[model samples]
Target: MVAADSTMRMEPAWRVLGCRGCGSAIVECALVLAKIPYEREEADYATKEGRDRLVQLNPLAQVPTVILPDGTVMTESAALVLYIGGVAPELGLVPDVRDPLRREFLRWLMFLVAAVYPTFTYGDEPAKWTHDGEEELRRTTDEHRKSLWRLVEGAVRGPWFLGETPSALDLYVSVMTRWRPRREWFAQNCPRLYKIALAVDADPRLAGVWADNFPA
Candidate 1:
């Protein structure tokens, strides 16, 4: 019943632990849009203790793990966006349940999570997948990821993913373009999506968060 209580602002604080450049940046961006009070703890997934700490909170040992004020833990970037969007409807990050674009919102959000994010999770460091042909695998995955971005570029409707207003979908894509082969490649291959990314990057609501998460 998150949507039912969308207008209510709870007093509890929230803390998310993850690397700034990772998907956790999406969660941080959503929190800023929601105008919710929260803090971030930078965790280095490279170290043993760092990995162990994340595993302790989230069995998956993933970044973007949120510690709710009530001692409850939350995971997954998409779910966090939905939850925070519900908690703060004034921001328009989450569409109304009855709105037709709601379906589109959910679809693109899941698409980013299921398809786009995995590229970095597996492609950026293919050695984690197998030692025999890591180089080839990385190259293949990088190309596949670029192709996926092109598909998304064609799907965008302009100004934002759902059109006119900003949403969690745009923010997700924005942070993602900053990774891997980098934004230059994306700009050339997926011009439309690259524009959406730039718009999200320059959004007034997200301006501060973007600067903090991605410094020049």
Candidate 2:
């Protein structure tokens, strides 16, 4: 709940390790949606050179690492989300940073990463990652991915994941949860999150990210 917990008092300098057409970039985009100030460092995930830089910060070579002004260099998209929200908790971008809420936040965020996130990007290639789904598994994985999206769509309670103000989760979920080539799936299925995604798109602050990734 980055949106619900961020504060108006803090204004920290930021640098996000992001990429094109990926989850990390989407979270960086979400920071913009919440009016969080940040600088962007683009990474080409498909290239080895990109992997090398990300290895220095995060061996996983993932995107959405938010470099804190204090040089925290936070990795893990969800960890970065929590870190940024801590700088300005009043903004409510994440849940409370040090209590029952913190645990709850991590629970959902991890579920998204472990269960939901993989179903999207890797849905097209489960065989490569899992080995169990060799040969012709993409079709099944894709179908499962869509089924997961339907679940995500149903989870949305309103204009945002938790409520009115979109949180860090919304950013990640919106981009990752999109229906992909099935563009209208969200609307044809979970009308609510689809509308939520549309609202996230309409946000002017997020223009930089979309322009850099899904550009016209």
Q: For residues 18-136, could you state the per-residue lDDT of candidate 2 as single tens digits?
A: 77767766667656645666677777666788878877887667776667767777777676667667766777778775644456456667777777666655765465567776444
In model 2, state the lDDT of residue 115: 75
lDDT of 1 by residue, 1-216 (tens): 012135444755688887767888899888877767677787767678778889889987888899987888999999899999888987889888988889989988888899887877887668889899998888888888878877788778787888887788888888988897688987888777788888888778676566666777
Worst 10 residues of 1 by lDDT: 1-10
The count of backbone overlaps in candidate 1 is 0
lDDT by candidate, in order shown: 0.81, 0.67
RMSD of each: 4.3, 5.1
Q: What is the C-alpha local distance difference test score of candidate 1?
A: 0.81
What local lDDT score does residue 50 receive in model 2, on the 0 to 100 scale?
82
Regions of candidate 2 where Cα sits further than 4 Å from its true position: 1-13, 33-36, 97-107, 124-127, 130-135, 178-182
